[model samples]
Target chain A: MKNVKKVLAIALASVMAFATVACGNEGTPAVGTESGKTAAAGTWRIGGIGPTTGGAAVYGQAVQNGAQIAVDEINAAGGINGVMIEYTFEDDENIAEKGVNAYNSLKDWGMQMLLGTVTTTPCIAVSAEAAADNMFLLTPSGSSTDILEGKTNAFQVCFTDPNQGQGSAQYIGENNMASKVAVIYDSSNAYSQGIYEKFAQEAKNYSFEIVSAEAFTADSNTDFSVQLQKAKDAGAELLFLPIYCEQSALILTQANAMGYKPTIFSCDGMDGILTLDNFDVALAEGVILLTPFVADATDDATVSFVTKYQAAYGEIPNQFAADAYDGVYIIKAAIEAANATPDMSVSDLCDALKEAMVNITVDGLTGTGMTWEATGEVSKDPKAMVIKDGVYVGY
Target chain B: MKLRNKFKFDKRARQSLITYAMVIIAFVVVQILLATGSMTSLMKGLLVPLCVYAILAVSLNLTVGILGELSLGHAGFMCIGAFTGAFFSKCVQDVITIGWLRISIAIILGSAMAGLFGFLIGMPVLRLKGDYLAIVTLGFGEIIKTVVNVVYIGRDENGFHFSIKSNMDLNMTENGKTIVKGAQGITGTPKDATFTIGIILLLVTLFIVLNLINSRDGRAIMAIRDNRIAAESVGINITKYKLMAFSISAALAGSAGVLYAHNLNTLTASTNNFGYNMSINILVFVVLGGIGNIRGSIIGAVILTLLPELLRSFNLDNLRMLIYAIILIVVMLFNSAPSFIQFREKVTAVVKSKLPKKGGVN
Candidate 1:
């Protein structure tokens, strides 16, 4: 018994010692080695942020592939300034919180410049955090005009939808046909509401009277017959439906069944021209919308991008995916221009990128010269697309 | 004979003060590391869930190992605690000036709030005493989540506070704003949590549980586990003691929720649903760790958390889940009998081979 007690005491003491030592080791600082630039040497490490999973997974994957294609092309062309450019991707899951987490994680891994987020919330969150961390961020798809309102460290390569709204308004005014337009949109969606707000504000400029503007819930919204009937009774000749492709298709389908046929003007996403078994092309024909890219819309750079993407993906890429592809290349351009080496500090690379992106114009895949304004807003001319015979064609 | 009696080993020894002292020391060391921000993000992410699962598994040990009752919906109590804690934390953040004090107060208040919910929910549910109890708790969890979704979301507009049906006309206000963001989740939470704080909270729970298990009440509770009718015949307040265990589990879960909410800086109603999967997962850790053993639960938590991360570098995101399954199966297979002996012997031999036989007189 005495021996057993003694053994127990010794065992307990040893356990306590082990626990203390383990806990002690946990508190010590990670040994700082050479910075990423010095350790890897003479390589540009650009970072990409997108929702690799969740609601915007398709969008995120497109951006990732676009970045990969650009990097492969750049590397094949004897690299940038005799140094190879590498890319790191972070799955932000289309969430602002995850975006912040991913941004911090990438910074810790020693990335230099970042491609902005695919979704609006994450784009705003990541850009704000990048500014705080003093990193350069550029986005290709998140075109909420509010994003370009005040941000300095971040730049948008896509023209704001308000620019497209202005163009849409000009088109409507030039036709000189419709006076009253009814607008239906999803308020909760930043993209939808952002374009809606700009379109409504710009309609006043063209003296196009907005008879009624109503916001509906995104997922739970089912019967728009009541809303459509009200618009028809109001003699609305032009119905501007700024919504997602699936929901817009449903709304237009529902409106056609209700016998309320009106000229539809939508924002960029409406150009997707999605068709359901219930969706008839006659209901969607002559639908006008603005887009940054069309799959067959050929330019030297765009054709090359689409050809390479098709070679790899074996399918035509959508506008969102095409935009994401451009987003990746834009980051690569900034990184290559900065001549970022792994040894340099993230802030140092960002400083170089700031000079690189400012008033920086490039003849991108869009076939238009993309330049940044003083506020880092891109000056890309958005092309308006019209759905002709159930297909979107650039006009 | 007298000397032998004096030196006799106590088989059912009570927890010694020295154990508590050692736990405190360990807690202090962990805190030092966390406060200094030296811990990696993986470590930081694992820390809260570890401490949370530990509290849950051990407190749950009381139900399964002590009271011999299987109760699910533990995550529901945690959800209650999280929201309650978040509400208080947000209030205190706006009303108070100091950050650290707000965190300390929020945790205490959150735990108490969870305890209250546990008491209310556990009372009638504990009476059912078996599968019925589990079902009721599960229902309670679903009800909480559903309520969060259906409830009108309130926001603080510039000055005019009201729920806006559409984007075109949203009035702004400050007073009477919707406190809870509902299904969209409550964002903008303060990130005041650290690894040290989590470790300290876990150690406190361990101390409390160990102290409880070493008491007379604990032995009686264990008696109920072995034979409920026998314990009841001996005037053991079966219902009362079971309620105590349930409330304690709820309080600990609530504290874990508070820690989780503050650490992650976000809260969603879905996080709380006392789904069967979560209940089983927590139970898996407890059972895997050797039920009723605090050390075992800690080990289980660490292993479970690290296993997924270790699989990440393989770049085979598809194969990661398969590997995890294989690891779990292997661990479960070796869970019973003589495995520890073999493991220790292998470790000892490896260490001995690595080092030169102590005294080459060098």
Candidate 2:
């Protein structure tokens, strides 16, 4: 027992030592040191929250990459109003409780504004405290309206779920793509359910026949054979998939194996489907979806942003990255429009930034003429694109 | 001799009292910190979650630790309670504007509903043992999440309607409101969960669990755990005791769920809430805390829940999980290894020898 106690004590002491060393590393790079240029005035401290280490880590990495790129570019171009942007990124692990903790930690660090909380759930979780504290939170890819509803200080860069869903339906109807449609969505996901519901509602207006609609939760096994078979039996010419990329890839794989070929219509959730490994690009051929940003757009701004993003990250920026990249620009524009000064208190700046966000129109990589609605939702036109030869092309 | 006997402590009762005292002390310390503004907002935000996790770990310990059964569907009960509590609170939001009172009633109703589910699932599941039981319970958790996702409840001019297909099938009036939006989940739930209430509920859980541990039934359950056939020969109805312990465990977990649901404005049936990962997380707390030790469970839950957040402040974002894993393994080793126990005893003996002994007080 004595030996055991000594060992236990040693272990405890070592763990504490490791913790101290880890904490010591955090202080090495203090806030406001992102750029080599010294701030003549006070720096604008911004906090970015996302899941950098969990199931949604990829999206979080993309968001961080985009936001960091924007910050670097701004700082290189003589900083925002001659004050460098000091950004801190916190990993929330895609959990609400952790997200709240990250929010508090950043707030304690004297952050004037928040740039992210990449996913929908964390965005919703963090927005509550953000509203109470009067902190401005601009989420790049949290498309759920639930995050923005009744929250004055929270703003989203991505088009809301309803917009994507309704836009998809309009595109299908106007283009005369399909007379009969079937829907398969993850009922457990807020983003999926939100888009699916709006699509169902809008389908009535389009005079399309709803053949079959099947629901599955996130906990369901990967085999979507039953749902796919049902849609096939219903003779669906178009299948609406309002789920994320991974799930869409699996569903498409299952449908392909079953020889169920249907023109797939999806929302922004399926944006990164083509990037999945072992995903037969042929299965996704002719798949159409509405996205706020497309990499292949011929516009100069789009080409420039895409080229820069590829050079920086060695990959094409998906809609999530594009939205996050735009989020930083929007924040800069809002701060400039509000005439925010270094003398203003954090709370005062946050209030001014919130008011400014409501009035300013941002023309960023995602879309031009982007404006915020009274509901804190962003209004922007999305492009209709179809996957061809493993690349997204405007339909 | 009588005076000496009076001073003699009943070991079990003393242990129980110690557990309660530890909880009180921790709560007081946190309260003081909050009052002094020394605790970061991140730590303050964790206070309620810490309570909820402690409650879950302790109740889960009742089954996995004392009962010696591997029940993996504890999160299913939590899911039931969360949705039930959120739904009840949503319905009575305007009627009972008092946050505390509404949450109080919601807690009772939610636990009762969870208890009912526990009883219903336990009736047949308790017959199985070991790994088979674990698989079934896991399946049950998955089923609960899926069912909640597909089940849509809405209120209209006519009345409340339930539908499995879609919310559109609910066929409600124009003034209708969806209380449960299938996968969209229960949103706009009353945020009434304060650290004070969470700690209070945790105390209540401790009181019930510790008392149960000392009761005759607890001994009988433990007896079954030790030797089921021998216990059956001794005329202990194995099934009855198992179900009782399991149902109680579920009810307590349900209470934790209610606390969790009220803490958040939006509650969804996602992996973070009512999925397999959450169940496993609670199990980890129980195991890492020294199975069957209630106080250990609380400590484990509090430490593990805060570890990630604490690590985040260190900017070790990528290595946080690796560090957490290392600490968890070391703690577990110290908790159960024979060599570690021997080392601990030696240190304690030396420390006791260095200290002066009490004399006349006894």
Candidate 3:
């Protein structure tokens, strides 16, 4: 009898607490804007979503910082079409449900457009909801095909995962970087698997043979001596790492220890390896990677963005930061091209932006005259850069 | 008929009714708030998931609290249920156009499949006791997640094809669709899960778990939990009772997974989805709610799940987790400290004496 009362007592108390929290807010309508032209805030609300704190925080934090820099510049230049652009970012923690919740939170804050969700899996989930709501979404660094597969309303600033994979294969084949290549990838991650699968398939078109394909799980990400040794034993001239730099750093150090110095090649995930804490820079001396942005590029646009980003964030911006910087400018172009107004409905603006995205090409930090396809893929050429004296340089 | 006639408004009956009424009243209040658009959007989005964690916590309690065994792999069972349930929904969604009917069938199938795995695993695993069982369950749990990542299935005009190698080996026709795409997971699963359905499932889980805990078998199970060898010496079938508790607990966890899968569009098998961390989280709910307390688990799951998301609203991204950690320690002290419980009991007793008695239901 005592136990029964205890159960009922706790249950009742908890329910009351929940009820109070649920009724804490008196919300307006859940949707962004009504069908008819509604009186709107003079500022364009652009909401960003990404993992601000987690294993993938590097990417999300870069995107957020980069977008903030661009937004500040745009608003300083008298905003987009003379209306100030209001920017807000929500942290998704790289979880799909949390990402959707962040999207809803942004909607509650009266977001007119979305600029992110830097990771892939969460982007896929959020993109689906954005597609249903007919919201205009432009992800900065979400490179998976699934994120934009059927969602025409969604666009990417970075090249798709397949583009990097196919481009790497073609680049290597064109320059004859290596005849025998050994690939190491993280199979647990969708982005790595997506790139690896395409690269392997595309490699058949080139003269190089993928000698050995080694895989690792998220749990087994650390300790790549076995993988490095296998690649060395295969007499591979080049080693392809379709993984993030966190693991790639350990792999390079281990390979250095074992005296197996093959030509190291990677995708964009290795762009900011030099900035990693406690990592020896000499290990990455001759590493080559296919990326859209090189922080040390002498080009005026790249140098300006890089300089401003470093002044603000106190670090060299990676490819993710560059993509997000390009994302904001591209949104500016889309709005100007469509002549979209703050008073227009969300669906109306989405339709206008969808058409404008493909027609208007914007030259920005990541690419020049970058145009988007109706398929939601960005058409951008990737530059092959090599690590020289600890800084990335043109190959 | 005689038993039905003999059913009276006893103390136990009244207690159970209070629990039911509490759930009902809360549901009604939320529905009103939702209709009026008064609930915060973050809370609104978290509605189904709150129910999911609550259900998962309660189900896990059946094993850790009632069965007196530590199972760190309960999330593995959840992963199995989620993937299978989502897969079934994707396969038959077109044929079974009705939402409620298909969801009903999916829940049953998902629960049954989880129970089947639990029973089969329990056969070999039940022989071991204590930490050995925990280690083995944890091992198998990871194995399940790892296996699902590699498994790929597709559907075409000809039929269904399965592959462990890769999605390419499925060799589906041009018109065929790849249902499972390795690590990318099943996309475009119909969003059939609703808050109403989640609440109904929670109620169903509470009924089964609470009634099971009160039955004759429940006594035997508890007796075994208290003194396994003594209960066995007194003619209790230890293996039978233990396996029964475990498999049923797993089935309920599976039902919770059904809700989890349908709630999200992209269903991928990540470590955070169903891994060591998730199992530890459910265990924390069971332990914090007070071992073997069903109502406490529900409340604990709700509060803990909402605490982090609620804190996010304040824009304290850096300090959000730090605050959550402090609150967790404080709650642990309140729930477990010997002096605190004594103080709380005295305070509650005084409060209870001043409350008026309600009319008994006849």
Candidate 4:
């Protein structure tokens, strides 16, 4: 008994020491936020919150790396409004409570401006907390209109849910993509559910007849055979998936095994499919999606941003990255318009940015001449991209 | 009996006091930290959740330890409480403008709703023992989460509208506002859960549970746990005691849920927060704290909840979860393994003998 006790104690002690040393091993961050010290003057402290550790990590990581690239470029170009930007992204683990904790921690570190919360639920949770403080927030990929409802302090870098749905239906209708459509979406996620509601409403005006609409929750995300087989049996020519890449990758594989193949259409949520670990890139072939950015675009801004991102992270950046990259520049433009300094209080800066956000137009890698309304929704035309040779090409 | 009367503490009363004092001291220390400006805002935010988890652990220990029944659906009771309470607050937030009064009624309503479900589920569930009971409770937890996910409730000037099909099915006037959006859940709940209130609730849980355990009903319940046949032979109402313990445990868990729903800025149904994952986490707290040991469960919950956050503050950002898993394994082994328990008992005996005895010692 004594021997067992000693052995367990020794093992736990060693493991604790190892955990301390392992913090700096990951290339993510050497240290986390300081508790008491606020951001110093002359540096605009911007904090981001997202799920860097959970099921939706792909979106969070893309946004984290993408926002970093933008900050680096702006600092190299002599800073935003003559002040350097300091960016810190906290992992929310894709849970609402943790997202609020992340927001409060960022506030503790004297964050002046916010750019985050990659997913919808956490974004909604954090936006409510941020609204209470009247902090200026620009979510890069949180496309739920609920995040902006009754709160003028928050804005979306990506199009709102209705916009994506309306845009996709219009594209499919004008191009005569398909006559019969089947939709499979995550009903629990605000991002997926919001888009699905609008898409179902908008599909009424299109040429397609809705054959099947199946819903899945996050807990039941693993098996898509049920949802897929139902859609296949409906004889739908096109499957519209308004969900994330994490589940879409599995859905495509499951559908493939069931010998079901149909034209696939998705929203910006399916942007990082090729980069998902252990996913066969070939399975995602011919999957067309409506998004604001395509990495392979020949535009000089897209090429430069894509090249820099690949050189830095050794992988092609996705639409989430593009949105985050544009988010920072949009923040810079709004800051320039307001002539706000880092020395200002968070509430003052938020108030100034709120007015300036409506008046600024940004030409970014995501979109050229992007503008936002006082409703906190961005106005930008989403482009259609098809996966060919495992890369997104203009449809 | 004369010595016990003179000392003003039997073993049971002393044990209960220790649990109360443990909570009180911790609350005082936290208050001091807050007043001193030493505590971080993140830690302050977690204080209410700590109370919630501690309450959950203590209540679950009652069903698992005292009743000797394995219940994996305690979180299901919690979810019922959370949604019911949240629904009431949403419907009447306008009518009941007073925060404390509204929240008090919400807690009572939430507790009653959860207790009703516990009684209903325990009727059939308590008939099964061991693994069968465990499986059914697990199913109950999943069923609650899934049911809440599909349920949509909205209210307008006309009345209340509810639908299981879709939110669109609830065709209300343009002025109508949704209280619960099917999967997304209720948001903007009044964040009224404070640390002081949490501590008070924890005390109430301890008071009720400790008192229940020392009562004649608790003795009957434990007898039923020890030997069901023997307990039945002694004329103890087996089903009555069993249902009593189970329902009370479920109701305490419901109070925790009431605190939880009000603590968050948004209330949503998800696996991580309200499903089997959370039920298992509470079970871990109970088991690691030595099952029936009420004080130990609270200590375990507080430590496990704060461990990751404390590690995060120490700059072990990503490694905290990994280290937390390892610590849980080690603690569970130390707690439950026979050899480790034997070793701990031996060491404590030696230490006790080394100390000088007081007059109360025979």
The candidate that achieves the highest TM-score relative to the unseen native structure: 3
RMSD of each: 7.3, 4.1, 3.8, 4.9
TM-score of 1: 0.72
Write the residue-wise lDDT of candidate 1 on B174-228 in tens digits. Answer: 3444445434344445666666677778778877777677678877878877888
User: Candidate order by lDDT, highest to lowest?
Assistant: 3, 4, 2, 1
Q: Model 1: what is its DockQ?
A: 0.10
TM-score list, all predictions: 0.72, 0.91, 0.93, 0.90
Candidate 4 residues A50-169, lDDT tens each?
Answer: 888877787899899999999999999999877788888888999988888788767655678899889888898889888988999999998888899889899999999988888888
Worst 10 residues of 1 chain B by lDDT: B159-168
lDDT of 3 by residue, A200-265 (tens): 889999999999888887778888988888999999999999789999999999999999999999
Q: Which segments of model 2 are wrong by more than 4 Å? A: A2-41, B1-9, B229-235, B338-362
> What's the candidate order when arranged by decreasing DockQ?
3, 2, 4, 1
The predicted structure with the larger lDDT, 1 or 2, is 2
What TM-score does model 2 achieve against the real structure?
0.91
Model 2 lDDT per residue over B143-227, tens place: 9987888889999878899998777889998899999988778878878999999989999999999988888999899999999
Each model's DockQ? 0.10, 0.41, 0.47, 0.32
How much is the lDDT of residue A70 in candidate 1?
Answer: 79
Worst 10 residues of 1 chain A by lDDT: A23-32
lDDT of each: 0.66, 0.84, 0.86, 0.85
- Residue pairs with colliding backbones in model 3 are none
Q: Return whichever of 1 and 3 wins on DockQ.
A: 3
Best by DockQ: 3
